[model samples]
Target: MPTALDRPTERPADARGRVAELRAVRAQAVAGPSARATEAQHAKGKLTARERIELLVDPGSFHEVEQLRRHRATGFGLEAKRPYTDGVITGWGMVEGRTVFVYAHDFRIFGALRKAYGGAYIVMESQSIGADLTYAWPTNETAVMGAEGAANVTFRRQIANAEDPEAARAHMVKEYKSELMHPYYAAERGLVDDVIDPAGTREVLIKSLAMLRTKHADLPPRKHGNQPQ
Candidate 1:
């Protein structure tokens, strides 16, 4: 009797062949125009997903896993469309010799739509292998900034209609209260481990990596799905 890692005695070769065929179909589907288009878009941005990962990790130390997985969609009308890594790039690598798993949104393709298979695989793998740290930088800050600016404009207009200029002053106070208060709140809640100057990002990451190396041994294993249980 063969083990699961080998060939199971119960399963037929036809079934295994079908599995291999489906994997091949998935790879072929996503390896076409969509993948090329996505790469071109990233090139235009002067930032490939892989380059971003390289910058974030230690030079010559990062090792990537699962670089070839692609989207598997069989939905109506979408069956013909290949989603190109489901619009997200995921893999594990070393940051200053510390192991970590990362997933970055590919804003150039499908706006980071979740592919059922690839998405689930990354999520499950990350959970099982675990990572010392996770980092997420929003790729769509332009939209967020626009919405915030619009809200500020609306508040200013409303303030101008007030009977007292003091009321208008209060609007300014409220605006800062909402916007500027968050960073301090994040620090207090420990949501942001640290906030460092942009120029010091490399130094900060190095220090963080050092700290994690020593600290990781003391910390318990990370739970799957990031749940405590």
Candidate 2:
């Protein structure tokens, strides 16, 4: 009375057939619907669903699960057309030798949430932000200058005295864009520990992690009001 798992070992033919079926399903999942659609996706400066996962994860570490699952939607003739994996690739993999779960939607195969209108597309686009900074959105002009508090306030007063309000605003916008968007400002202000070129990113990260392995920090005492410069 062998179990189902044991049966595969006993019956070689059945095991071979099972492996062949698995390979076929994997091929379908990798290729999506057609070669033409996959090529079009590549042309748009975007990697395919599988390629993205592979690049993010460590080499030969990705173990995809639910590769044969299909959507059960029936209302809009979805039952008649059931694409493999339901247009979503999900699995667990390693990034920098650390375990991570990944999920990617196949835009080519199943366009489930189609962007029909322009506004609808914008709304959809806003949902996928990496961080939420809505709390600072309603802050005053001082917020735009980051932590340069007194210096920025003095600069603002000088600009206000020298130029008209509209002209000051234009200058402020230019200054804000220049300082806030670039990496140099943050690096100079000691907000960032270090900044490295894209080519040395991996090497720097590994070294930083090694250095911080035994690092400890002591939080500074909370001070009331501003300190004198």
Which run of 10 residues does model 1 get worst, by summed lDDT? 135-144
> How high a TM-score does candidate 2 get?
0.45
Which residue pairs in candidate 1 have backbone atoms (N, alpha carbon, C) closer than 3 angstroms, thus clashing?
Answer: none
Put down candidate 2 lDDT per residue, 48-119, tens digits, no spaces.
778867766678999988887777677977666677777878898865765656666788876532221223
Q: What C-alpha lDDT, on a 0 to 100 scale, does residue 61 get in candidate 2?
A: 90
Q: Return model 1's CA RMSD, one decimal.
A: 11.1
Q: Estimate each model's TM-score.
A: 0.45, 0.45
Q: How much does each candidate deviate from the true structure in C-alpha RMSD?
A: 11.1, 15.0
How many residue pairs clash in each candidate at the backbone level?
Answer: 0, 0
lDDT of 1 by residue, 131-175 (tens): 444222222111112323444565666656778756675666666
lDDT of each: 0.50, 0.56
- lDDT over C-alpha atoms for residue 82 of model 1: 48
